[model samples]
Target: MTTADLHTLTGAYALHALPEDERREFERHLGDCEACTQEVRELSATAARLGLAVAETPPRELRERVLREITTVRQEPPAHGRRGRTVTTGRTGRWSGYALAACIAAAAAFGGVAVWQNQVAQDARQEANQATRQNEQLAQVLSAPDAKTTSGELTGGARGTVVVSQDRNQAVFLASGMERPPSGKVYQLWFNDEGTMRSAGLMNPAASDDAVLLDGPVDRATGMGITVEPAGGSAEPTSDPVALMDFPTA
Candidate 1:
């Protein structure tokens, strides 16, 4: 490839889309070309971040569509031909093939980046929406006219609290210094109805110190309790309560 062509391949090189032979040539050129090397580095870092931006899996239809196109897309022809075929001289024919391929690869790299950019933006918006919903739920319980707060000490000197709003039929659980459960286990919240226990929800492992809105209505439960249970939580508590707090009397 020509010097100009090699320069144009920086994006393609960063994306690893160049064929084997051209990729080796580009690597050797990178050692002497400072500009190309810097461009490659920036593009590579952007690519890595985009890869991690989305957690949802791609749809199967997208994969199948791409596979179908691969079969029908016509590949570029070779730059030179057999002795019997006409061969144009100079850049018009010999170098045109390589240049065309390099340009296409560069375009593909930019297109891929664009698609990732859109996906990342969508993921960010979705997370923001979820956070907003959670905040609203917490606010409802905290601001209710009948809201009552109860505190208790958890195992290992941790602290736990519940903000119950009977009028709204909602409650929020808060914890501080709550350590992660051991492997194969999780922390679960429960509604204590007299002597019977009903599962409230599994405590979030990601944020041990954050407030969590209880999963179900406070209903007739007189108090809340926490227990260590197997991962995914149990239908019923199988262990002793680590923490319990009874709601204040009316």
Candidate 2:
């Protein structure tokens, strides 16, 4: 085989998918070709990482499908060597067919695992970016020289604090020792602008200690409040205030 053709087979060889005759020929080439040897090693390591990334259960019919294909397929005779004689398979042909089938199944499974791992990594990256944005928003509020903090107790034995920026255009709310809301209900935050109440955001009830960056136009709000509302929250206060704290305008 030409060196180029042998080079193309490096991946198949690394995956153990090459036929025995071709495998032996490739091994001979490996002895004198340092580049091919390094290529094969790197490909083999990549395949190993693909396999270990995720545990996959092969399809139940994989073996049956392989055996079925083998029954209908014909094997090619080995290439003639320098002595001009074809290599004889003898009784090993049957085992070699099964080995080829297993290799194919393994390769397919690894391909699926690599895709799954890629998606998992992408999701983790998105979550990290979201966290970074939240932190940046909170830092803006905390570092402002005109920042003010106020604390209050809620109806359900929960306590919370609100940190408002100088311009009151941004704020952060932190809650602790809060009980999980009853089913079909959620904790909702509101900004009291004059006598009008506007929705800020919803809170996760299960968290014992939670922090959220409040949506803005907060400078217009004279105070902030929390209430238990329906799952999706309400446009206006659906229940009396569970907690209320005034924002220092001065």
Candidate 3:
């Protein structure tokens, strides 16, 4: 096969998915080819790095597992000829068993790192959520009606002004600017009726004036919110919401 074909086969070889004939051909070519060997080595190292990205705890008995596998791998005996006598004169080493142990140790170290990163990420997410809810509370306070219209903004024109009726049973989310979601998803408006958030309707996430207009004689609505949901609005939100406006009521 050409050099280009060999390069393309590197990934598949690391995954052990190459066909038997192709595998044999590549092995034959590799026996005398330095470039192919380098390519395969680089790809194997890259695969090893990716494997490190997923943190997993190795079994406590991993050494035993390695030993078992090594035992099962049959070594080819040297043919009884002049070459057999020469083989006995060659270097005798048992480092291969030790090399397998090193590979397992490397895998375990990577698994540990991945798990640590995941934990750090999860904590950061929780902190962000707490900050968001606090900001929502502040917005609710700032938007409360007092026989006069009130307004506020999030940084970078990212926040929208909220207007609530004096009686507070009805409101409208007049959003001037917002990011658009991809196809097969929509921004759904909702009302927190007596602590239960209820769907009002979905809006055009891309339109300049396609407001997430909400009108409800909705009972005990303490929270007004908007969520980017699936193509069809969900019965309940499963993802983090985009906008959650809090309204003041008597």
Choose 2 or 3, whichever is better by TM-score: 2
Runs off by more than 4 Å, candidate 3: 1-156, 166-168
Model 2 RMSD to the real structure?
24.7
Worst 10 contiguous positions by lDDT, candidate 2:
86-95
lDDT of 3 by residue, 1-250 (tens): 5533443344334333345465555554455555555555555445334322333445859834753343233222222222313211101112234554664578687776566446645543443344334333323423444412334453236556555554444454545445545555666778877667888755443332332235355457766677778655678876776766666443
| lDDT computed for candidate 3 | 0.48
For candidate 1, lDDT tens digit of each residue in 145-189? Answer: 787887878888878777788888888777766775665566788
Report residue 83 deviation for candidate 2 (angstroms): 62
Candidate 2: residue 27 lDDT (0-100): 60
Best of the candidates, lDDT? 1
lDDT of 3 at 61: 98
Pairs with backbone N, CA or C atoms under 3 Å apart (clashes), candidate 2: 168-219
lDDT of 2 by residue, 1-250 (tens): 6654465455445544455466566665665565665666555555434422333445869845753443233333322211343332211222234655675578677776566446645543443344345544666676567878888786667788777886648887777667756655767889988878898876643344556667566867888888998765688998888888888656
Q: How accurate locally, in lDDT, is each candidate?
A: 0.62, 0.60, 0.48
